[model samples]
Target chain A: MDVLTTPLTAFSQYFSKSDYVLALPMILLTVFALGILMIDLMLPEEWKRLNALTALIGLGFSAAAVFRIHSLLGPEVSCIPGFFGTVVMDRFAVYFFYLFLVGAAVAVLMSVKYLEIERENHGEYYALILFSVIGMMAMACGYDIIMLFIGLELMALSTYVLVGFLRRDQRSNEAALKYLILGAFSSGIFAYGLSLFYGLTGSTNLGTIAQGLEKRISANPNDPVVIFALLAVSTGLLFKIAAVPFHQWAPDAYEGAPTAITGFMSVAVKSAAWALLLRMFLFGFYPLRALYVPMLIFVALATLTGGNLAAITQTNTKRLLAYSSIAHVGYMLLGLIASDGTSNTTGIKGIMFYLLVYTFMNLGAFAVIASLRRREIIGDDLDDLAGLYKKAPVEAVLMLIFLLSLAGIPPLAGFYGKYFIFLSLVETGHFALAGIAVLYAVVGLYYYLKMANAMFMREETTAEPVKSSPSMSLALAICAIGTIGIGLFPNVFIELVNWSMSGANAATIAQLMH
Target chain B: MMPVATTFFFYFLSIIAVVSAIVVITRKSPVHSALALITTLLSLAGLYLMLYAPFVAAVQIVLYAGGIMVLFLFVIMLVNLEKAQLEERFNKQWQVALIAVLTLGALLIFIFEKGRSVFPQTVTNFPENTNTQVIGLLLYRDYLMPFELASLLLLVAIVGAVVMAKKRV
Candidate 1:
């Protein structure tokens, strides 16, 4: 038998040219992370800040590789499968890849000073973030459930250490343990779901699974195995995104983890999970939409209500933002519910646009918190933020802009993101759900403004002036511009998302035609 | 193929596994519990081999029984032994957890009933150790991406272990 005696086959059989070229980004990221680890050992303590630049350069190189792949694939939306079709360099992946890079860049910028403030400024921090971004890009590019699982584990494992990276703090240790326990449980459940899907379809490839499920569902509409798979898979991902019922770990984790890692979890992790969810629904579970959609509807409603109501009771600013993040997941799920996975631009584009908008808004908010979080003072309390206007005028104003945008004010990026989702929902005739989403958004605004009101309206609590480094300010500036720019000129970003997803929409249309 | 000896061995393994699992929970000393856990794991591996999955059985014995259980014992010993013994046996919410578990078990039975059409009772015969070759080829070929990505996860775990246990950042 060839298996017993033959030498390995040539690489050409399993890998296309794109596998090597498109893979350059992840390869370089890994090299950079390892290089930083080695370099950190040799560098004198005084020169440790150089790791940030090294990380930025690595990110820049990988982003440029993404662009090169984009040009190679051309403007026509196409899925250029590689790594034996387990991964694809498609416009959908490219979109998320770019967003992840942008989020990583901003997070690194925010961390530069904050790490020094907390006295945990190690090169491994930057290396870990880069590694986490690689996992996210893998999830975005994954066309196989196994690929997605590995990607999720890579991201989740890196983040667990990153959360507890503040080893000296007991709160950080507790948060890390809780997150690890809950996260591992969810991963187990997720794997169980994937196993069931594999058993039912006898395939792991998304395309093959889709084909198999469509035939099976046509014969038996209420397939218990498929419904259970949907429940298990969604539960696992919803935990990642910090949606309701599975969200117990989030508030404490967000409040305990170093501020920058919290922002990373809120943005990069959320986007990666959403990307996987979208892929699963659009591909493997397409025939069971009727089965899965009701589940999502119930989840979205509960998440919105629980997130806003619990947020209203939180005194810790970090905890409030945690709840707010949950509420945002609810809004994004609406877009998924509205889309039928055909050549529909509105729903997918809305989710993409909202994720991008959320990156700027959420990162900007955390940057303000980081600015105030110096050694000996963990200033993430609503009371501490009171009179923030007097302590740091620029931060206060930027926080106001960010919070208002998060609250979905007109002419801001968040409003457009929500509006697009609402538009899609109306088009899909989910008028009641659309109305509930809006009402919840209004309720969410109240809590968001409480932060703003405390900052601008309350008297000073301390005489301390919030000190922020140039790099942190630069991150804030980028976020502020994005929040305002996308808000003011919404069409540019919306059009870009539509163009990138054109390839995905085409793929979906072909699948529907089957 | 339907040997009485094999059937007798299967039931023996199942009974041992259930009894050891119960002992694992009931034991007062963590060391005793960990020992019981190893017995449970070894019996489960025997069950897997009897089900024609020799590779899985080997992995179960090697990873769970040998590697993980040792680690578990080490942790139980390393932690404050006196304080752990003094703490409550169960949490305040054990009753709620028990009720929830029972409900879940009932729901699973309902699901099994609903999907009974596909839950075939017969088991297929396979050539000895063929699953090893089949799984190896699958992992190395079509699932190569995830296979490699799994290595990345392990690397992350290693990094996490070092970062968490290290004295200084």
Candidate 2:
């Protein structure tokens, strides 16, 4: 009895309040998710909307927890390792946590009306959204490979279901199946790579792995195992970001998923992947920067070319945006490639800023499409947008703002996003890459304007005005304000990104610079 | 450098695993294919045992051979087999599959060739009887976060299956 009690006490002592405090946001979300599932079982059909309200409250509370952690940690503490260092409390994680929660909240707001229209309103929908956001938060904060993998799977599995939520639609079924098979395959490759690293380092803790990797690299500067692991891991991550040659699933999945979910996936899911990529490279595998930078350049060039070239012929609105998102991935990758192993934090900061802006603008664009969804019309075709200006003047103007911002026009957040990337590229003296990226940006504008032209110039295809619920309008308004606000006051958002970069990993990045 | 018995058992398990795995894909009958899969799984478990990972081998046997096999057989039995057999066995997509396989094979070979130089590091051996205890401690202590997250992941999987398969939600 004494021995048993001793072990139990020792185990209980291992987890202090700080552990739970750092993980509070994710913990709160999980609780709310479980609560929603339990509540859904008892709630009547008419009251299903309460789940959405519950989810919003959960997000709000989680956000408050994030800010609480921020205030508690203050600006001086770089990061605090929590849960035995499997996760970390850091400004970087806090920043992305806010981004994910905000993206998720707006997604929920946009989803209510869309789900109601599709006659697919259910509590599970909101629960799944919350669950996926939990996964994204984990990805943002995870400090170990195992935690990252589990987090990635959680997010992937939820989205796979969400993508095919419309069970009656055949296209949705096909897209879900495709995404599932491909995503699972990539995850397997990713695990193999991480296992190789574990074998090489004899540890899963990223800090320990970094030390081990440095030793391995110094001993055998050209270790093939390191290259193989890098390639395998990057393949998996690039697939998630929908980069070139691995992006085939994105267009189909985007076209097939519920419009509101498409918004969530494009914004929150992609940003989560970018966060993971930055963490893995800048922290665990920084010693191999010389080996990976060339690889990123080629992939970025191909992604830009393939994504823009492919988008030119797309008639469907969702598929076109999917390609455009792929192109944006290309630009961000260029930012990554421009990261010099010196104290220059511009490249990484550019990616963070770009992702922040992308969340608002892209989700706004998707929300507009979701608003166009009617009972009979699928409302995804470019022709469907004809004379949207006549029917819904306000919505059309908002859509125009989203499109122009996406096209990198001045006075829009998208332009600042591209501007930072270009500035980083030139700062790192990649003038050639900068020139090519600018050319692709011009090409991207063509397709975006194509949609805009149809909206304002063509005749009305349907007599009914675009009907959007108040919640959707709120979502649109949030996105519009965020996109325009960030653009007009770029300095403020830049400061926010700069504050996030001033974390423990910022030290790791600084080490990479020199 | 190695004991003769251990090396022979390693080769024996490898051969069986490869042969059964090949049989799994080549068999025309779904039942036969599933049975071959079980053989493949069991042989892989034996291989794991040879590597001193008894816990993994046990899990492979119980989960893959025992639990999932039952699910596979039940589904196979419920589906109408004769009508499926009469339908097209192969689609025009075989070309794409072939290309993908070739590319993957080429990559594996390339990696294996380059990795040969770094393959001869020391192999750490743990005490045989303490294997389970060590793993349990590591999972519950140092790896607790991932362990709990895995439970949540499985929950998502269950929820996803329900959402995708059920006629109504």
Candidate 3:
């Protein structure tokens, strides 16, 4: 009885502020999600394509809403109310929310053709993707550990189903089982860490946790529980990001899951996880730098070595890219480590910029792969890509741009992304790590170039040309444009990156130096 | 209730949790393994009660032990379990297991050695307020967004599960 009356009062209280600008995007996305669901249910089987169309519309509106909100709220505003203080509306979160929306939109576009080809096209697929997008948005904006965990699980559980969407396939089943078991295990570890943190800090909000850590560190200085709890939490996050030593499931899962969904997972999931990682580490655990920096550095090195070495031997293209992504994670971690000891915006900017560039090039690369045909004669082997240039010149060229970008070739988005990241490392005096990262980048170039060479240089084995859907062509074109545009006019993107990093750096310095 | 009985119960529950966890991992049949998992989860609920978090204990029993485990059992039953034909889906790495055990033992020793400096015993009374009440207040007041978002997560999970289990279009 009280609950009924209370929400009405709460609603009235919320409206009295007359400042719904901060909440407009969430409101828009929520409404759009429900609208899409309704449309999905109302549409007939043949009109199921409307689901994808509706999702695209929803995402577009949400993206526009985000821009409007950003404009209205300015850069560094926090609109927290009630007791929860769970959702934060700041530039840092807004940046990620936009990224999630764009990534999901591209993923939906990429899925259209793949789903059609596999004859597994369904409205639920689109709906689930939107749901996962909502989860990613929540995770990105979450200000507290409980919100983070719920959002993480929401995304994970949905992806688990998405991974095993092709139920009859043995590999898909295996992937789902592996993911479920490992995901549950990691979640349990994370929850235990949360419990430990709660025991020590008596709070779950990131800001409160930071305050507690500052106090505890000054008092105890060398308590092992502090380090243990930090390790456990980082371990859980590391699992999510698929960093080395915990990346065993990534390759198999990527190889087995539908290619389009794999693309979505690689970009959207990684971006969201990194967003959460940045928030947690930079905000909540900044005072414990001595505990995290060295551990992260070692993990980065291991991830680089393991990812590159494993990629060199991979026969399947998807698995190869999976390992490649792991290596990219290593590079991203370099940005995190570079942010240590100083409140420089360059390092964080580099990370954010790279994530932006990566979303395009990586997804574009996967789009090209999704278009390739095995022909039952030459499966998804390296040989299948032979003479792709002659068979499908447009795709081959687009694929070239993606591979070049990923390899950090000049005049491509990938190059600028790496350039900024390396610049940050050097600026932070992480010269040795940056040097090692360059060396690994060269090693990565080998495999990416191999794919490019196979597509562009090798002669066609079959007379039949590869066919692709118009939707895929459009998606690839968008990615190509983004990759080249960001590379050429990087200043605009650089400004955006700078703006996002300023908030993060200010918050980090304020908490750490206190 | 003597403190001795409380201590005994703690030890017994801990042993059961460990044993059940082991069984959950080792059992050949997925169904049997899932059942063992339920036992492990129940014992964990008991452990939660011992820790003075009765609300968490209740949640553990209701959500995990009752709700989630049932879903797991149902899914296991729904899937053609014959396909599993358990020859260990994962590679058998006894060496890694042995290494894990040894590492755990070493860690325990280190923990004991360091315990003196860190967790010095101080007799303190547990808070009088009920765990449920406190948690409810925190959830509704401090963690309201997360509480609401958790419902959203459940809604997504329900939608996703139905989608995945449905007949292909």
Best by lDDT: 2
RMSD of each: 5.5, 5.4, 6.8
**lDDT for position A383 in model 3:** 69
Give the per-residue lDDT of model 3 (tens digit) for A1-514. Answer: 2221121023332322322444556556667767777776777767777778888887888888788756644443323222335665556787888788878888888888677656677776777787787778778777778888888887888888889887767888899889889988998888788777766777777777888888888887787798888888988899999999899989988888888888889999899999888888887787788778889999999999999999998878888999999999999898888875245667778788999999999999888888884333323567677888888889889888998899899999999888877998998899999999999999999998888778788887777667777778888887899999999999999888777666555555653354
Model 3 chain A scores worst on lDDT over the 10 consecutive residues at: A1-10
Model 1, A1-514: lDDT tens digits are 2221111122355554556776888888988988888898888877888999999999999999888777665554366667766886778888999889999999999998888877888888898898898899889989888888889889988998899988888999999999999999999999998888887777777877888788888988997777888788888888888888889999999999999889988998889988888888887788888898888888889999999999999999999999999999999988998986574558778898899999999999998998888767898899889999988899999999999999999978889989889999998889999999999999989999999999999998887778889999999999999999999998889878877778777665454344
Better of 1 and 3 by TM-score: 1
CAPRI docking class of candidate 3: acceptable
lDDT of 2 by residue, A11-82 (tens): 243877767777789889999999999998999888888889999999999999888777765555666667
Fnat for each predicted structure, in order:
0.64, 0.66, 0.62
Name the best candidate (by DockQ).
Answer: 2
Ranking by TM-score: 2, 1, 3
Chain A: TM-score in each model? 0.96, 0.96, 0.93
Candidate 2 residue pairs in backbone clash: A341-A512, A341-A513, A341-A514, A342-A513
The TM-score of predicted model 2 comes to 0.87
Candidates by DockQ, descending order = 2, 1, 3
How far in Å is the alpha carbon of A256 misplaced in model 2?
0.9
TM-score winner, 2 or 3? 2
> Where is model 1 chain B poorest over a 10-residue stretch in terms of lDDT?
B115-124
DockQ, model 3, C-alpha based: 0.35
